[model samples]
Target: MESQVTNNANALRLFFTDDVFVVEDKSVQIVLPAVTEAVSATVSIPKVEAKEAVVVVENTVIPAEKPLPPSESYAQKGEILPIVEEPLQPKAFKFLGGNKKSVLILVNDAAYDVSTEQGRELLRKIVKAVDLATPDFALLNYANYKGTTYAELHQFFKPQIMLSFGVEASHLQLNLNWAGEIIVHETTRIIFAPNLHPLDSDLSAKKSLWGNLQKIK
Candidate 1:
């Protein structure tokens, strides 16, 4: 009912002017012409086609990787295992003399073959000067028996006098720095000197060794 009243008020505004005041007798009448037929509007919409989805698959082959064998399997493949070196067996003490007088003579000469008669000629002369022979003392090459301890030598040779040449007391496992000195250790007279191979031409060293040898005897 309120909407109807609003529509009627809008219609009255179109007929009345703001500046003019009209009396009932001076009012003008307006009539709008009507159409004989009613008109209708029609809208057309376009149609879209529906499509099915396509999928592609590929067939690929991957080779399997061979696995590694255990450490023991190496032997089956003709491959040797890592060489674990055994502890160096204590070398059997090889001496040139009979050691009748319990005198141990040591020399370090890897270059010269002391086993030969000509090679040991200098050693023969040195022993002869001290009034000794091959049978009187044990001649040992320190080069061959490098890691031999003092206890091992003492047990084997039972040396009363150890005349070492070209080797130090420490080489025999004796910790003393008694090189070029004559000292009695455990009743064994030890004299360390330069290599006798060079002493053939060294007169002063030979004289000094001889002087020490006399006291030991």
Candidate 2:
């Protein structure tokens, strides 16, 4: 009790008196929460890949099928690759019927197989309807010869009467804006009509074509 009271009296004296103060050096200890197992919160992001754009084409013609050449390395040292040139295709107008009366019948269906029996039968009917025979007029598929001119046709067939089916005068390089339904260019009497295939079933078209046919020559 005596020592306690004495120590308290010294402390009070030091506080009251203008004495030199001293600070004690000590390390600070922080009390944190108890260590626990961490919960996983990993977010996964999916990888995106790029794709090629698609294109659409109309009246697309697939190239002719040919066998692939030998896979030899053409890149040789001190050697040159051979330059290949495609052969020029011949432009001959192949017709079905004989042009006996200097009459021309033009069709625009090259894809259509005219060599078949059905095709021949249909052609026979068409010619008969026009009051002509197979040998009387030249049946030319002008679609095969796309850019044929009036002068070229005239020189080739020497036609006095031309009946165009599913083909325009502009296609034959004829500027016949002034000409009526039945055109009289030079000596050739031209009549532009619908395709022959449709005329077989279309009564109205057949009547109209028949009427127009009489007007030409």
Candidate 3:
């Protein structure tokens, strides 16, 4: 009991002594950034660069299709151009899907759905004539692609060749010979094919069209 009293007295003395440490109740201040200031400081967005000046392409005619040379014996064969080796049945047939540039387009005004039997047949011949599989091609309608200029199209698709089917499709923008002649409207090389209406039964037209397609590549 006496020792407890002594310890208490010692603690009291220490508290009163000037050498002992003392703590003050001082308030601390904290600063926070405003929402707008935080956002401006933290976030950054990039701007898109403007497009280059447009190219004014004067109408330059593509080289005319030459007569079929000696090696291609398919020219002399009967005007009937058969797509497949064996007989083709009427079941669902699809011949499209391939790498780009093989055909930037196969524009037509007829709106012939290639999903149908007759359309499939024509597409087969067209694909075969180019010596490319159906997958490696693209099809367009004149009505749809009228807005984009030829130079923009060339810059984007950079097609190795362009094939236009039917008169309206060819004449829409491309100044081509309407007689199913393969011609160039400008710097781009194009194949101006006959309208699908007459080409359905006309084997001679198919032969001639197929003959012209061989010139591409």
Candidate 4:
């Protein structure tokens, strides 16, 4: 009789005989009796670590409301605004009279006040002496005269002749278009004293004065 045994990491085989017994490695060949038995070894497997879990969250926000704009106001009734007017300035008058041209004689001096009635009379006498029918004359005295009154005199009689007698350094202003035959007599001739008109016939005398004044160049 014969016997044999074999062992492996996972399994083992064994046999028995009357005469002899033998032992061999797992991969080696072995002869065994018909009553042999095989045994399988149990194996243990390790568990793997669980995978990590993931979480998802969703959030939403809403904004606050804003205020609206205010409405416009209505205008009030019965409000009156004042009108503005500009002040008037003085202006010289131009010549408008035809062949019957007028004359203006001015004696600009500090020694005489032509604005006064006495001074005007003296100047009228002097102008009359130039000719018995000498043109109408007016003397503007700036020394004693106001600017408003002088402007008024310019407005009243638009003369054609302007004479500055005994004038020092002051300038006599007259309308250039209306004034003609400007004469400057510095002498104290007072020849005009005899040419005085009747106090009652001032208008007729003025007419005669303008007629004679037209004869001047």
Q: What order do you get sorting by TM-score, best first?
A: 1, 2, 3, 4
Kindly indicate the candidate among 2 and 3 with the higher lDDT: 2
Clashing residue pair totals per candidate (backbone < 3 A)? 0, 0, 4, 9
lDDT of 4 by residue, 123-165 (tens): 5564556552433334444444423332344445544443434
**Model 2 score (lDDT):** 0.74
Model 3 residue 122 distance off true place after TM-score fit, in angstroms? 1.5
Judging by lDDT, tell me the better candidate of 1 and 3. Answer: 1
> Residue by residue across 1-217, what tens digits does model 1's lDDT show?
4464444777888777588765686466656687666656555666666666666666667778778675665366667778997754444688888899999998888875463454367677768877898789988888887778877788778899998888787777787877456888888988887777676667788787888877865
Which candidate number has the best lDDT?
Answer: 1
lDDT of each: 0.77, 0.74, 0.59, 0.41
Q: Candidates 2 and 4: which is better by lDDT?
A: 2
lDDT tens digits by residue: candidate 2, 1-217: 4564545776788667776678664675667889997978887877777667766658878999898996877677779878897643444678977889889988777667442454456567657766787788888887788787877888788899888777787888888862336778999888876666654567776666677766753
How close to the true structure is residue 132 of candidate 2, measured as C-alpha lDDT? Answer: 86
Ranking by lDDT: 1, 2, 3, 4
The weakest ten consecutive residues by lDDT in model 2 span: 113-122
Instruction: Return whichever of 1 and 4 wins on lDDT.
Output: 1
Compared with the true structure, what per-residue lDDT tens digits does model 3 show for residues 47-132? 78898989998999999999876696665667776666663233221223553555755444435543346655776767776677
